[model samples]
Target: MSAATRAPRTCSIDAGSVLEQSDGSASGIGGTGHNAAIPSSGIGGTGHENTIPPGGIGGTEHNVAVQSSGIGGTGHDTAIPPGGIGGTGHENSIPPGGIGGTGHEPGVPPGGIGGTGIVAAGTLMNVSGIITAEDYTKKQLQLAKGDQICPGDTIATNQDAKVKIQFADGAILHLLKNTEISLVDYNYSPQQPELNRSLIILAKGDIRSISGKMSKLNPQKYSFKTPSSTIRVIGTDFLVTHLLQQEGALDAGTYTKVISGEVSVQSTTSTIRLRAGESSHVMLNGTQSIITSGGGTCSVH
Candidate 1:
């Protein structure tokens, strides 16, 4: 014998522009209140009784609401009593819906496996140290002290990625993208030989360094070592970049340009000071010439 199968029914209750009242009275969204006892659709009987409870604006009851269009199995027929009103027997089942209200069921549930989880649009991915387009591929990565970064790693533009470096003595370095820089060493100590030092080798990139704890505690402990010379900051901000000269008989040397603050060059034979609007060239002979800013006798670039 064929089992009995019932069709799904849907009824919507519109509490149009109504709000609940503090006096337990039914208030419409438009601030109108009504005091009356609400009636139900039916209790598994042949009757239609719609209701708005005494203290409720609007609500509906169902006997057996089958939202999905599925076949009923044998020995278990589907039946929704008219007036019985479906109770909260099954609450852990998937609700019938589809992507963006499209309602296209691919013979599977809405939130099936291997589906992208729901999330708020325009979410940003924040990370520490350097972050590039590649880093976002994975869920997470570690960025701890004494970490070395290479080119194209953790790369990002001014708006995409950013890197912040804090020195032992409180110096900070903020680096932007398409920028290559190396953190050689960072030491901050106040004892003999003063272990506090900051060495950054800007191979061919831009870096912004801010003098902080180390500079305030011991101003002499800060240094930005590039390919050319060591930049001794006077507790100020500066940008450093190393430009490679054309290839010659041997490997070409590098030149340093100072955007701001004061940088001093100390070589075996002489000591040169560089200020804003000055440049220096580091030769293969370990010799440096102060191009400008009035340090000493040196060749002009």
Candidate 2:
């Protein structure tokens, strides 16, 4: 009886680096010789009868293999480039199976995916005249060059015909007509809370503002500086108006009206809290408000 002996199989060559020989004298060692290979098992196949399988390195049994680009180093099939995004590797054998990505479960709504976020809705003056002209669907408003309001442009809404200006912060500024209003300054930075401040100087006109999400997060960042007082909102919708009294009348007093939500009115002498539909009057002497029936407007004296 004789024993059958098989030649030693080559060890797997690493895809990360090229194989180096200590003696360096095989057929493909320094020259291109077909028999100079270390065998399909090793770095180079050296036998004429040996065959190189398709999934050579790791083998198809485990679904992993050495990926080579014919370069000096051997790379794993899963190797990712530096500073480059890697693609998710998926499993093909398992049913409903996938590797490394947000997978949706059955009967469940996936969470909202973030978008590029070009601009928030109701962002005014964002569309340029050129783009408006090119797209028929795009609406355009021809604001006069001279009439264009710069950063500090201030205007009072007419008491008869009010106006509303929507800001990028999703705030609605209802301007009362015939009332004096000035845009002291307006800036928004969703990134930084401290620098995200909006200020309006109400010289006369009434204003009803619905603070946006940004303002709600940082209440101290927003202020409405009125003629006789400054209204600071904690987190609610409110109305504020400044009325100029007649030069000669029975009693001329500055009125601080609160349509809805609480507002702190800081008069020359004191701080007064007026609830919804309440009014506080600040006279030369001081501040006063007359309590009325439920939901009734208060008259200050």
TM-score of each: 0.38, 0.44
TM-score between model 1 and native: 0.38
Whose TM-score is greatest here?
Answer: 2
**Candidate 1 lDDT over residue span 1-301, tens digit each:** 1111322111001112122333432221122332223222211111111122111112222223421111110111112110001122221132221111111123321110001111111111223444432221122233333332311123233344456654434556666654545443333334422324444556554567666666655457556665656666776666654546554542344455556666666544455666667766666455776666544344223
Per-candidate clashes come to 22, 21
lDDT of each: 0.36, 0.37
For candidate 2, write residues 60-112 as lDDT tens digits: 11112321111111112222210001212223211110001111223211110
TM-score of 2: 0.44
Instruction: List ranges where model 1 is wrong by over 4 Å.
Output: 1-170, 176-178, 189-195, 245-253, 267-270, 284-287, 294-301
lDDT of 1: 0.36
